[model samples]
Target: MVSERSSKEFFAVTLRVWRQAGPSASGRFVDYPATNVSPDMSFLELLDVVNDGLTVKDEEPIAFAHDCREGICGTCSCTINGKPHGPGHGIATCQLYMRSFKDGDTIIVEPFRARAFPLVKDLVTDRSAFDRIQQAGGFISVRTGAAPDANSIPVPKDDADLAMDAATCIGCGACVAACKNASAMLFVAAKVSHLGLMPQGQPERDKRVLAMVQAMDEAGFGNCTNQYECSAVCPKLITHDFIARMNRDYVKALFKAKFKPVSSASGGAG
Candidate 1:
């Protein structure tokens, strides 16, 4: 990745955006120009211009999901210019800048393509598969009225730090998108670790990892090959180490639950 330097005519970027109509529809890249774009404009704002251009041309505008236009929602997920969350460390695509490109640069944007992420529209995919995995018991099942003080339970600082690291997952799906096999290893492991680190998550304990991993497999997500690409592009910068931890948890879960996780071609989702 070479740095492009210019202070003039930053607009006129060539955008190659994937256009998908629906779940059953196959998508293709379409070119649109980013006219009058300023360097300071957020990447999505620049896309807004492009969409407006297409709408004026009476062509269907490319539909990309975004809200709060801030990076935190994790909903503004897109694979920008072949990089998940665009060109930088730990930044969402919405936080990317037009300055990352120069005039006449061709930018490619696409939805997160994973079997788990079934394309819902142009740049929006159904990530509820992740939600389902969470619902499969990623939580501590305490009745609502059982509110305890923030420090009710004393979690060791080391464990707390690790849990916080795992909890940093924004559910952006970048890990799934970046992997060659579209493995959701990082995402699943984060959830597993986030819960496994604390005492509150003890009730479900072994069952949580087992069930979530099973759901991940059934959702058609590929197994992690240890290539580490998923962790590399993760917006939260979650590491493959979490996957290793998850495997250990899963192995423990197998004995505790009395049900073994099915080992497929790639060693059962890493």
Candidate 2:
């Protein structure tokens, strides 16, 4: 648990932020002193203060991504001192508070590094790779008609609860950043399982698993060796067990696709 600091207490830290002009431009860490920082201030808020100082000095301010300052939107992604989403569990960078650090700390901030998530500028990375992967499968087609009653499709309580856990993934790409192999298995698995477990998703389960895994490989993400680091830094606290579930689904799908008649495989394998 994080200990609370006094409301009147203020501290200072050296912000070591990465600076880059473009995708191909050179980049380096530039340090700036952040003074009069309140413990209650969010990490992004501290960056805002630093940027304000830079703007006033006729210097280009730091670039970082953020939306819906609440942790719901995973747009605010960055590495702080080599940890994805900074020093906290189940919290995105936007949700990290200044109190997590000590006074006089040198905070190192940089973009999430991975071949799939190319760096844009400073702390921003192009995480649209996740979008492409999602577009490949991460959904179920529904008939365009009146909405069905919730109780019409009764799901087991256990399955419903597990599906909701997987659905919490916000596509932050923190898993890719945290893994030594830069594997996106956890992200793909969560996407696959959340929908695959539902009755509506059964029709395309095999297809979805195959397509998403293929897309993940094509996006240049490495294979998961099961080091389990991906789950270690996930802001959503998504478990690695989802990866196992996805792997089983992929194997079953592949086996059926190879042996079953094409016509018979249309509705997907068990």
| lDDT for residue 24 in candidate 2, whole number 0-100 | 97
Q: Go through the candidates in order and give each one's C-alpha lDDT.
A: 0.85, 0.94
Superposed Cα RMSD, model 2: 3.1
lDDT of 1 by residue, 98-148 (tens): 777777788899998888888888998889988988888778878788567
After superposition, which runs of candidate 2 have C-alpha atoms over 4 Å from their true positions? Answer: 1-3, 262-270
Per-model TM values vs. the true structure = 0.89, 0.95
Candidate 1 residue pairs that clash: none
Query: Cα lDDT of model 2 overall?
Result: 0.94
Candidate 1, which ten residues in sequence have the lowest lDDT sum? 1-10
| Position 90, candidate 2: lDDT | 87
193-268, model 2: which lDDT tens digit per residue?
9999888899999999999999999999998999998899998999999999999999999998899865645565
